[model samples]
Structure formats: C-alpha cells, structure tokens
Target: MQGHGYGQPVKQPPHTAWLVLLRVLFVAIGLFSIGFLAWAMMLRLAAVTRRSLDWGLFIAVLAADILSIALLSMEPGDEIRTTSGNFAMFLLLGTLVATIAYYLAADIRHFMQREQAYAAQRTAQAAYAYRGPASPHTPPPMPHTPVPRTPPATPPPQRPAPTHIEQVRAELDELSDYLRKHDGRHDSHESGR
Candidate 1:
C-alpha cells in the first residue's frame, strides 16, 4: 500500500537530523567564540545565566561571524577560497539554529495553549457537574427516556432492494419455470438447433 509520508518517523520534521547536526556545530562555534576569542564573554556571563542563554549564544555567533568575515576579507585569492569554507559553515549553522529554535518555540507555545484549553474545559465540566441542576425543586434530567425502544417493530421484516444480480437470478428462475411449462423447450427452437 502507498503512504503519504517518505518513510520518516511519525511527528518529526523532515530535516530534523540535519538541524541537530547544525546545532552541534553552532554550539561549537558559540563556545569557541565566547571561551577564548571574545573579551565580552565574562561581562555577558551573569546576564546570560540570569536571563536567556539564547541571547548570549546569539551574541557569540555574531562575533564569530564578524571575525570570520574580517579574516576572509583580508586573505588572498586562493587563501580566501579556502578560508571562506569556515565562514560558510558558520553562516549555514546559524540559519539552521535560528530556524529550528523558532519552530521549536512555536511548537512549545501551541502545546501549552492546547493543554491550557483542555484544562479549562475539564474544570468547566467539573464545575457544571458539581452545581447539579439550576433549580433544586426540579428532578435531575432523566437520560432521555430511551425512546421506548422495541426493536424498531422489526420494520415489518422489509424485503431488501433488488440488485441487478438478484433481478437476473429471479429472471432465470422465471425462465426455467416457463420452460418447464412449455415441455422443457420451445418446439421451433429445438427444431432450429
């Protein structure tokens, strides 16, 4: 049987593995830039730890990209070609990291919203059930009386609609009965045969 998917596992984005690989590279670049290359790492450490690591990583990535860009711009022709590979890698990793992060955040937000809605609905149903009926004098609504069901009166045992096959069978039976009435075959047909 044919399926709509390309054999990927359920509920995963198409390029998730590639995104994961890029994230690894992105992390390496971020660590390298902040650890030994940039002087602002210490200054940003407290803020980044307190707030969001994403902003710190983003700043590190930016500094790395700028450094790579500047180094590549100073290189000669063939050297530039060789060194540009690192810059390209960083650029591609950055884009993938940002894209995956955005999508992940959106997915988390939607999941939280869906969970909250479900929780609200459950609470509302619980409250309604606890409150019972609006009027205490009124009896609880009896679950709809069951329509006095009596096997639907057996619907008079209706004969089914005749399909083409059934009609053909009946016609064949009628023909056999007619042949039997006429001494098995028409005289003219037997003579011709």
Candidate 2:
C-alpha cells in the first residue's frame, strides 16, 4: 500500500490590516473625547484651582485637532495628479493634529491621577469615621434570653364506686351454674321434638 499523506491546508481570506488600523484610530478618537469630558468634570468637582482655564485650553486644542484632521481628509487626491504642495499641506496638518492630541492626553492623565488621589482620601475618611470614639451611635450587642421551665404533672383523681344496677348484674352471673343444671333435661327433650 502507498504511504498515507496529510490533508491539504485550508485557505483563508487575505488580512485587511489597513482597514483594521483605520477602525482602531476612529475608536481611539471617540474614547479620547469621552475621557476628556470625564476628566474635566472630576477636576471641577474636586475644587481644583484654575479648572475653568484648564478645560478651556483642552477644548480649544481638541477643536483645532479635529478641524485639521477634517480638512486634511477632504483634500483632493487622484492616482495621477499628486503635487508637492499637497503633500506639504498634509504633513503640516498631521503634525498640528498630533501636537494637540498629545496636549489633551497629558492633561487627561494628570486629572485622572488627581481624581484617584481624592477617591483614596475619601475612603480613608470613611474608615476613620467607623472606628472613631467621638460618635456614640454604635449599635449595642444583642441580649441573651433564658428559656422558660415547665411545671411537673399531677396524678389523675380516683374514680367513684359502681351504681346498684351494676351490683345486680354480678349476682345473676353467680347463680348461672344452678340454672344451667336444672334446664339441661328440658332443653334436650325440646330439641328431640
């Protein structure tokens, strides 16, 4: 017999790396905007100084970055009409967008760090409040209750003697033997007839 051989390899569609990269970029942009908003809110709540200025700068930088990206994406491009001016414009726009993105990212990182610190402080304060003796509102321990004991049982009362009719029934049973002897012959004659 011929030697056994391995099965043929299954083929798969080609990888769309460029499309995947573009999708990832769009997702990053959306997340960055959300994170920026959250950071701004946290800073305001924590009563940080100059929070308004910080937020204003952040918004301006983000707007500029988005506008530059939009303009660059809308620029005309064809297979045969590429020019040096167009390339330079694209590079400049990309650089400005990247710089603004980096500035916003740095600010967001700083705000997150401060928020985490505030959260930790609040947690520590709660722990202290629970353990402190200044408050007399602590719950009291549960009381233990004793089970009740049952009383001992008493014996039933003695019954009274039987009535006169019950005594007559006992006397009749005692005379049953004499009556049986006297009626034996009569009973046998009646049976024969």
Candidate 3:
C-alpha cells in the first residue's frame, strides 16, 4: 500500500465505478425532486397571487409532463407517432423549460430581496445597540459595587438606664444594712453592762 500525506495508506472505495454511478443516480433524483417542487410551488403561487401568466405557465408545464410521459411509454407504431405528435412534444418540452427558468429566476430574486432586508434590519439593530454617549457634556455615572450580603455583627444587648424608683430602692437597701450593723454593736454593749 502506498503511504498518503500523513504516513497512512490511502483507503480506496471497493468499487469506484459503482460509487460514481450511485452519486450520479442520487444527483438525478435530487434534480428531479427540485424540478417537481418548483412546479408545485409555481402552481401554488399562481393560485394565491391570481396571476394569469403564472397560471398559464403552470398549466403548460403540467401538460408537458403528461404528454412527455405518454409519448416515451408508447410503442413505435402508436397513434401519436406522427409528425404532429413530434411537433407537440417539442412545443411542450420548450414550454416546460421556459416555465422552469422563469420560476427559478423569480425564486432566486425573492430570496435575495429577503436576505437584503434581513441584513438592513441587523445593521439598524446594531446601530441602536452601540449608541454613543447620550450627551458628551457630563461624565458617565460610576458602576455600582454590590455590597456583600454577610450577616450584621450584632451588638451585645445593653441594660436600659436605671429608673428613679429603682435607684431609690437600691439606696434604701444599703441604709438598712448599715443600721443593722450599728444596732448589733449597741446590743453587745448593753449585755456587758
């Protein structure tokens, strides 16, 4: 095996001709599908828009498809094997080609216009988004810093200020203690006597 660019052997298809044929077959299918889709789309557009020219073209193409199919399927000595039949086939095919071309062109134009509109809309939006300063006179406001949400440090609970009545009660209790001490000393003196 011959080494490729990266020191790897080039892998080849088992049947290159068969693969090529398959690709051609798929391409043909895709093209036919696209052609049919265009035909359908033109018919719908003609109906919705009520355009006489589009309707005529749509009918012509439909007739072309039917006639072509019939002609190709018939045996050589059939009734449609005459000069008139050949002329009809040619006219139908030409009409089909012209109709396909017209619709394709119209579709392309529609898409291009849509793309341009979208681009213009995007540009307008971008212009709005990147607006200049409202006024070149004043400075811009400072960016706000978010305060951290830590729990507040609670202060120790404080005693309320003493009331007048409570202060008087405290003084009276001190005086009673002093009088008790002095009266005990006097009682001791009397016992000695």
TM per candidate: 0.27, 0.27, 0.38
Per-residue error (Å), model 2, residue 173: 99
Candidate 3 residue spans exceeding 4 A from truth:
1-56, 67-80, 135-193
Give a tens-digit lDDT track for model 3, residues 1-193.
2322222222332354654464345334325653333346457547644668778877766666666656645636655676656765565556545655676565444444444455544543444354344333443343333332444488545877653333544566677779999999999999999
Q: Tens-digit lDDT track for model 2 on 127-178?
A: 4344323223442232333222333266545885643323434455556656
Highest-scoring model, TM-score = 3
Q: What stretches of model 1 exceed 4 Å from their correct place? A: 1-51, 77-79, 84-130, 133-193
Residue 72 accuracy (lDDT) in model 1: 57
lDDT of 3 at 101: 62
Best-to-worst order by TM-score is 3, 1, 2
Model 1: per-residue lDDT, tens digit, 1-193? 2323322222323254654564455445445553233223322332323445545554654565566556656666645365465665566456445534543454344344444455544543444344343332453333222222234445654678753333544666677778777974577678887
lDDT of each: 0.47, 0.45, 0.53
